[model samples]
Target: MKRPSRRRLIAATGAAAASFSLAGCSSDSGNGDGTPTGTSEPTTDGTATQEPTTDDGTDTGGSGEPVGADQLARWVPVSDAFEFDVRAASYYDADLTALAEHESDFYTGTYGRVAQSLLGAELVDIVPPESREHVVQIVPAFTIVLRTSMSAGELATAVTDAGLSETGTQGDATIFEGAVNSTQSTVAVVEGVVVQSFGSNAQNAVETVLAARSGETARLLSNNGEVRTTVDAIGESELLVVAERPEDASSNDPSLDGAIALGYGWQFDADTSNITIGVTYTEGETAEPSALASYLTEQDAFSDYGNVGSSVEGRTVFVTGDIATNQFDLLSAGTPGESSSATDAPQVQIAFEFEDGTMTVSHDGGDSITASNLSLVVGDSPAGSQFADQYEEVTAGDSVSVDVSNVESGTNVLVLWSDGRNSQMLAQAQVP
Candidate 1:
């Protein structure tokens, strides 16, 4: 296969960001405990006042007091049967409050109110069964804590009222099962914390929560040295994700095989947002960092977007940077590797037609070519002057036209196309 150009790679990254954002929106709406639906106000009576620590030494429940990072860390299950493990957490109440100002529907009515009551959440992705080889089935297990004012029964009642059926009781907790987006998900409220499992058999979710309550499971992620180091590096970000690649896993991707662990941290402030991604490679996996960085830098998506900075520390590579709030949408537009679908042939051919100070550009093949943003670069110049820009939208079809009447004659013009995320050279033409 021919190597993908930098522009194509950047486009893929933007597409991935778009997908991730869409997924978040959907997940927020139907997310087991996070779903913005519930009434029957939580009563202070019978609420758990004491913060109980699980076998892994993490606090389980309470109001006002957020779960410590250590507690959040210990929640990730460590298992050898899986190829990799991921752990993530968020302060939903704060996050939702910030979002509600712009998206009123997110905080409207009872569901919205209930969603804002959520304090924090931790999620785990378990290995898929052998039967489901083609599909990456992540049996999601999550723990969500509400305000101390809510009791376990009240939380369970709210879930049941929303649409799920109360199947049975697991110990003192009530088990509610329902089909979400065609997948049967099970949820239970233990103490003041709501534990849920989705995208798997209902029983699997119940069992995982039961194991967690009984303190029978291992705290694999928090105890790992590499994970701890990465978490420390993240240092108090509002959102965090940790992924570990198994030592024995097979993959054609060099980044997966080269790195033992990966960490991503996102910190959102009023004016600016910062995101940092770090990868820890195995000893002597020196070539992997550059290979991965080179692969990423080559993509058009990142080249024109974000103030990204990278550094090497022994066997680890850290990429950290900040982007203004307004620039965020542009950086997360198209999906990654999306430009490749436009053509299977080796090179992208850009046909340009110039007419009386006007230039029209077109490309044939690929799934679809979208250029939300267009710019013109003069020959041998490092920076391009912006001529056109689009946001969260694509100009479908195969052609786009631009006016270049102001250009000097005989100057080489490079046309760049970007759908917020990635950019590619559309065509080069010389002014007649």
Candidate 2:
């Protein structure tokens, strides 16, 4: 990873002036009513009022209001199981539509086509595009909500038209189950909202989200003080991602060692896209702004693409980066370890699963590689050397299996990428 040039760092410092500024940081005080203290009241219209805009229309800092809480408040409370809470408000800002379109593959790949079916053209027509907001909470099992203008009958007609059938009902919510792109999913549709859950216990997940949305259960923004403070610090943006850091987050990188939560906010511009990466440190832990700035600048995606800047507010450290519109493609090239400069040894992430007597290796993401270029190298020679030659191309989600029952459980398995002349380890795992 290359360091940002001195000129670029200066440019980044100037850009950071216009990017998200820290309103305040690390306030755990909350009203007993579940609402975190320091948040503004919601507007009469259901949605929370946004921060005041500048003369040219960009959001100016210092309102101290948690701008996007209305959407986050519609989801279940952040718990041990909650991994990512994402809000995409393309309707509010047309700029986000382009950004979302560019990252469509990521959404569909991560959440699967179930997300596409719910957020596809059909529902977009029923929902008021300008005011519609999509919130996706991933606990590994997804709980998605689309704030819409469609009534119950209209939503039913749209979902039915999309080949979904009513599976059951929970209170005022109607649950529908169906397959999109051969993937099974279930969604709960209630007045002015469409909820979906993908993975096991879909119905139960939908119910949980509905309970949170109706204020029957705890809401994330109101109950989770850590997340509330982090989000407020990041302020408003077109896309916001709030992820709860793991308790045992021991990272080789010093900047991430004691991270408690991560808040990422992106605001698009006519010529560039500005991103703010905020990391909440554990209590009593402090962040080194210079180290954070250097660490973030080296991130593969942003390495040579833009200027990087950093600032510390209380226990939260915010690193802001700007990427030019022309260089935007680098952001989708996959993260550091998942990608490389080699053309023959394409970037790929493989997951190895040992079951019964077989070891299945699946391509989770990154570039697609020719079958002949990949080899399962266990010890010196893999159990099934012919596994790679069986398929013409191995793509994301594609899996190849080899008989590993004879191999010891403690042996190591490696997925090697090669074009005969050159070879590199794409992924490796210990036999378990």
lDDT of each: 0.39, 0.48
- Per residue, candidate 2 scores C-alpha lDDT tens digits across 1-432 of 122221112112221111110100001110011000011111122353333334422221222332222453335432321222122110111122334444433322322122232233234444544435444433223344665556778877777787779987876788888754333457788765677554334555576566655544445554444566667777766555544443432354676667666556666555666777777787777579878777766654456446778899988889888765434332333432343323334655666677898888888887888887666655323347444666788888888788887776534454555453233445545455
Residue-wise C-alpha lDDT for candidate 1, range 1-432, written one tens digit per residue: 012222221112111111111111112222212111111111111232333335543433322222221132333333321222222211111222233332322112322222322221111121111111111112122223222235666666667765678888866667777864443557665654455544333355345434433444433333344545555554555444444444443433555455666555555555565766666667887444456666555544344336767777776677766655433322233332232221221233455578987766555443233333544444222122232343232333355566668755544445444443333334444445
**What is candidate 2's local distance difference test score?**
0.48
Number of the top candidate by lDDT?
2
**Per-model TM against the reference:** 0.48, 0.57
Backbone clashes, candidate 2: 0
| TM-score, cand. 2 | 0.57
How well does candidate 1 score on lDDT at residue 181?
A: 40
